[model samples]
Target: MKRAWSPGAVYVEFSSDPRDWPSVGVALLVLVGMGAALVLSFLVFDERRFGCMSGIEIGKTLVQVALRQLAQLASKNDEQLHREREELALQWSAELKAAVPQAVAYLESRVDDLDARIAELSSDPQLRRVYTNFNFEAHREAIDERRRMLAHAAAGLINPEITVERKARVERTLRALDPADILMLHGANLVPGRMRGESLLGTPSGGDDNPGRMRADLLLGTPSGDVLASSGCVRMQVSGGGAGQGVWTEVFITQLGLDVLTALRTYTQNRKLSFVVPGREYKETDRTEEAARKILAALPGLGDLVSWSTRRSSQVERLYDRPRPTRGFAVLRFRMCQWQDWKLRLENLIPIYDKAEVNLVVSAEVQARSRDAKREVFVAQFNGPHDLLRYPADDCEALWT
Candidate 1:
């Protein structure tokens, strides 16, 4: 018998001579025993046992590959998250940098204004004493910055009569009240004596008046007085002959109220917008012409079909002192010949009017006999920001109740 070897298998050749017969039989028996042993190993162990790597070795190799892949995936995710975070940080930083210049400019301008005002007031010894004696930090804690600035400006520049204690009280009250409530005090300050509470705070008295018109609730939840009355800026007095008699109420601005009104007016008038009409009485024709010019400027290129006229405020009838009209406002009424044209103009003008910030009371009204026959009017009046018109008791009650 001869044997030879290759890379994958072993080969054996047996001679056909009688002398090699015994050796061939021994070799055949040996090969059969080896095959039976291989079958027994397969039945006893897993199939992976016979592979290039054993069962345990193959499992270890697969686990190492899986771990390597998992580590690579986690690293990629971490890298992506880091890049996203960096991008957002850069974006916010750019926005903050862009806004910085405008903010700095505004602050510098305000500082310059205060410096000039202080320099002007520093000349007076009495004003110096008032400032030196004032508890600025305590007052600052009591009021917001905007109101504190106005109060200080008024006390220093406009009204020398405002005592330090009065300043403190006024600032506190101004902080407590809203712009509308302050305007209410201004309306009260216009009159000398006590006026009917309903005159300014209630609904208008007329056959076509809307008694159900919604009114905002006073911050001070009391039923009898407005926010001004609640804040001690105005005194509300109710009088009755007896329990069975009809009761009437009157309101008057207090000294504290006057200070608040003065401070607001002084500050606001100084910073009034360009288009706003100054708060002063105008002759009938002058008022009409000025209001017409303002309306035309805001809505340019209007044809002759749109006509405008100025009329005395209806409130003058009730608000004025007897015999002569002491104080009143003008209402500018615009009439359009065609209702469709009026609506189109009104819709286009509403946003424009608001954007202009003209500080005028703007409204639209429709006068119609039928849907087919109608007239539209766009009205603009300088009545401050609040409705100064006096209304009936029932209408006034309808607001809060």
Candidate 2:
């Protein structure tokens, strides 16, 4: 029953120098090695199967290392993708939202897509065939349904928590602006204000009736569109009208137009063609030069009655009267050259008239150089005290503004 050892079944090898050994001893050693191999073979079936188990352990270790490295790389990639998504989201919410047109377009496109879907649903004949569909116009019926839904949903907000900061910010920004800068203030404070008769027999007049006064802002607007204020209240006066009555009419002059019509002094009461409105705040258009006035006169509103002087073509030697600003009234005098028919220039010319008095412009011909240029003289004349002119006549001054 004992198993026999066979050299063919199992074997061992020796590589040491066997040539130096005794022949019998070597043969005996070889026989013993063979016997040991045969005994080992009887115990185990195959040596290759034992080596295979060790090889499996080494392969498992290599696989675990490779898997760990792959897992780490995948985690890094996931983190990078998350960061990229976050950055993109922030950019969309921040800088992209600031673009007014693009955001509006996106909202409109979404609404339009919804509209298309709603349209498609309403026209679905198959749906109508299946359901107990009543006879209804597609567009009209769809609109009615949408309206009903909108009425209900209107109470519920789509974007209920949008806060806006407009009112206070607008006020703060307006407060920051400097409209009345001193750099814009022009002219010296020449005359300030004067005291006059507090009308005794009047209807509780609470206004100043004084003569010498000027405004702080001497602003001027020119036909050239220049705005400047150069001088303060310049005073003027006028007298002689319906005297000796229980209430005699008296002429008083002050720069109430300037807003500083308090107790002020006289500028130069002597004699001057141009009178200052006292403050530099008068409109720039009011002080436009004669040349610019001519250019504007060709235009609609600009062509109405304006102040100008005239000379007679009959006698160049005769002196012509320039527009003179008096204390209570402004005056313009034009000469009649041949006492001829009224010219077109005279027709278009406006005669100043006040609400209190009605006056007529007796037109005649006069040869005079234009203030713009001392060029060839033309003839036209209008002379009449303006305050005497009344009503619709008074409205003529409006052509200048």
Instruction: Give me the candidate number with maximum TM-score.
Output: 1
> Model 1, poorest ten-residue lDDT window?
207-216
lDDT of each residue in 1-401, candidate 1, tens digit only: 87799999999898998998999999987765565555445554546554667656654554555558669999999999888666644543443344334333322332335445445645767555444333342233323434334333334322333455666576556555654455444433433221333332233421111111111112123332466777887675554447465554545557877767655543433342322111222343443544545554554322221221111121111121111233343233343333454456565655655665544444555555357755433332222211221111111111111
Model 2 TM-score (2 dp): 0.18
Q: What does the lDDT read for residue 396 in candidate 2?
A: 25
TM per prediction: 0.29, 0.18
| Residue 254 accuracy (lDDT) in model 1 | 71
Count the clashes in each prediction: 5, 41
lDDT of every predicted structure (CA atoms) = 0.43, 0.31
Show model 1 residue runs off by greater than 4 Å: 1-158, 191-226, 242-245, 268-401
